[model samples]
Each structure stands twice: as structure tokens, then as C-alpha cells.
Target: MTVILVTGGNRGIGLAIVQAVGTRVADATVLVGCRSTANAEEPIKELKKLGVPAKLKALEITITDDASIRAAVKVVEENHGKLDVLINNAAAVTLPKSTDLTDVRESWARTLDCVATSQVLVTKAFLPLLRKAEWGRVVMNSSARGSIGRNIALELPPSPHWLYNCSKAALNLATIDFRNAEVRDIPDERDHITFWTVSPGHCKTGFNNFRGVKDPAEGAEVIARLLESKRGEISSATFWEFEEGKFQQVPW
Candidate 1:
């Protein structure tokens, strides 16, 4: 059975991804990572109702906490020998509601910690398990705001949210660099690991005060597809967008 771990899988788009995988991939094991196991209780119950063969495991993974991350790694090691797929979907935007310029500095620091820096740490901690698997896939749940071309095309300000947009932009570059580095380190194992950065589109989630163009399930379609056992022949190390019921390649 394939072992998949999705960070921030407790609610919203993340929960939708977990549900989709659990319902679709009958033989897969879904480990739902949340800040606390309590947050996963309801989701786990909901997943149980699906009556699929996929097993559920709730792991505590506070994105900005090293101890929490290490504990999650330990749980995965003890339960599953290896992890086949990792979806980095945990992110935070702690900026003030007033949209004040004065709070940008502090907000930027906190945003980068959760949105970008912590993802690198989580991936590093899980690399050993990922390598042990037959084929490992790392998916970065990114945003369209990360795209410079899209921003320019839409005529949005250069720094749309100051922290959130820039952090995602940094994540996009990191995704490319990380993929390239993996290839360089394992030229013979090219088929072993696949990396992708995907935009979930405008989803009506808590991130945007529940105002968006798509539902959480709709936003999670591409991500769930990527995690499925019978996946399509997708190009490795590419960016994707969930649009109009299909996953399309998005230019960085």
C-alpha cells in the first residue's frame, strides 16, 4: 500500500485533499498532519464513513516547531517504514487585518517561517523516509500569487500582500532548486522522486475569509489526482494549476 502524508490536512482544502485520497485510493494509507491530533478527530471520523481501505493516522506537525516535526517523523517511522508522497499544504498568513504597513516586518518574518522555511525543514526531516520508498513524490501547495508573469498580467502591485506573495514566490524558486538538487544528487534515481509546485486556484477557504471562486473540493482536485495511484504521465519538476476541471502546467 502507498503511504501518503499531507500537512495541514485537518480542514479546508487540506481536508478535502485527504478525503479525496482516502475515498479514491482504496489501498493507500493517509497520514493527516495537523498542529494537534485533536484537530484531526473530526476529519478522521468523516473519512471513516467513506468505508475505503485506506487507513488513517493523525500526526502532530506544527510547521514552525522542530520538536513537533521530529515527533511526526518518529510516528511515521514507527508506523510505516517509508513515505511515498508528501504534500506540503501547511501555510500561514499572520498579517494584521487593518492592512497596516507598520506590521509588515513582523508579519513577513512569521509568514516566511511557516510558509517557506518550515517546508524546507519538514522535507529535510522526511527525505530519508522518502528515499526509502520505490517512488517518492513531493508536492508543494503553492499559490498563483507566486507567479511574476501572472501578477504582471493582472496588473496587481509588485508586492501584493508584502509577505504572503513574496513568500510563495520564494517557495516557487525553492521548489525548482530543490527539484534540481534532487536530480543532481540522484541522476541514476531520476524516476525515484518527483517534485511539483501546484496552485490551488481561488478557493473559498479560511485563508481568504471564505471568499473565492472555487470550493475547497474543487481546489483540491489536481492535488488529489497527483496523489492517486493511477496517475497520468506528468512531467517532473513542473508547476501546475487546477483550472476548469483539469490540471494545466503554469509558467513560473
Candidate 2:
């Protein structure tokens, strides 16, 4: 069976991704990465009630804690031997409450740690297991607000969370760096593990106070589509989102 691990899979868009992959991917086992296993109990039960065929298990992980990350690697390594897919869905941003330099600095540091730095660390920790799999895939959950191309074009209105946008942009660059490093000198692309960054759009989750335009399930569709596609069908180190009834590549 394919072994998949989704960070923050207990709620919001992460839960939706778990549901989508569980129902769509044949012979799959989804490890829901939660800070505490107890947090996942209700969600797992609800998913089972919905008749999702894939096996679902709660995994203990705290992305910011190095010890927790190490322990998580050990657990997955001991149980699964290899990880076929990894979805980096857990992230946070701190909106500054004041215009003071200290407050802004604190927000930037914390947000970058949660959204970009910690994600890279988690990926690094799990990479050995990823390499052992037949076809490893890594998906970074990013946002269109992170897109420098879009910002340059003035495609969207200015967002107040500048630090959050910068952090995600760092994530996007890191995705490309991972792909370049993994695929270097690899003649056949099939043998190389693929990396992708996806924008889930403005989903109505607690993260945004439910003010977003789309549902979390609708936002997760693009990620599900990317995972289901054949290795060659989608390029690595690219950004994508499902928009207006079709999948579209988001600008980097």
C-alpha cells in the first residue's frame, strides 16, 4: 500500500486533503500528522463514517520542535520503512497587532519559522524515508500571495500580512531547490522524486476566520489532482491551483 503522511491532517484544508486522498488513492494508508493523537480521534471517526476506504492513523508531530520531528521520523521509519508521499500542510502566520518595529520583527520571525524554516526541516528529516520509496512525492502547501510574479503584475490587491507572503515565497523557492538537487544528473525523470508547491486559494477555514471564498474541500481538489496524476503528467518544482473549473499553474 502507498504510505502517505499529511502534516496538520486533523483539521481545515489538511483534513480535506486527507479525505480526498483517502477516497481517491487506491490501496493507500494516510498518516494524519497531529501535534497530539487525541486531537485526531473525532476526525478519524467522522471520516470512517463517511466510508473512506483508506486506512487512517493519527501521527504525533510538532513541526516547530526538533525533538518532535526526530521522533516522528523514527516512528514512520520503524513502521512504514518508506514514505511514498508527504504533504506539508501545517503552517501559521502571526499578524502584527501594532506598527512597532519589535512587533513586526517578532511576527516575521515567528511566521517564517512556522511556514518556511520548520517545513524545510521536516522535509529534511523525512527525506531518507522518501528516497526509499518507489516513487516519492513532496507537496508544499503555499499560497498565491507568495507569488512574486503576481505581485509584480498587480494581479491581486495588497495583503496586510507581508511577512506571511514573504515566508511562502521562501517556501516556493525551497521547493525548486529541492527539485534541482534531487533531479540533478538523473537521466530518467521517473527515478527522481518529484516536488511541487500548491496554492489552495482562499479557503473558508478557521485560519481566515471563515471569510474565504471557497470551501476547504474545494481548495484541496488541486492537491488531490496533482497526487493522482502520473509522474510524467505533471512537472516537478511547479506551482498549481484549481481555478474556475480547471487546473492552472500559478506564477512563481
Candidate 2 lDDT over 84-135, as tens digits, reads: 9999999988887699999989989999999999999999999999989999
- Quote the lDDT for 40 in model 1: 97
| Native-structure RMSD, model 1 | 2.3
Off by over 4 Å in 2: 185-188
Q: Candidate 1 residues 188-239, lDDT tens each? A: 7545577888899889989889978899888888887776534337767788
Candidate 1 wrong stretches, greater than 4 Å: 97-102, 155-160, 229-232
lDDT of each: 0.84, 0.94
Model 2, residue 224: C-alpha shift (Å): 0.6
For candidate 1, the 10 contiguous residues with the lowest summed lDDT are 227-236
Model 2 earns a TM-score of 0.97
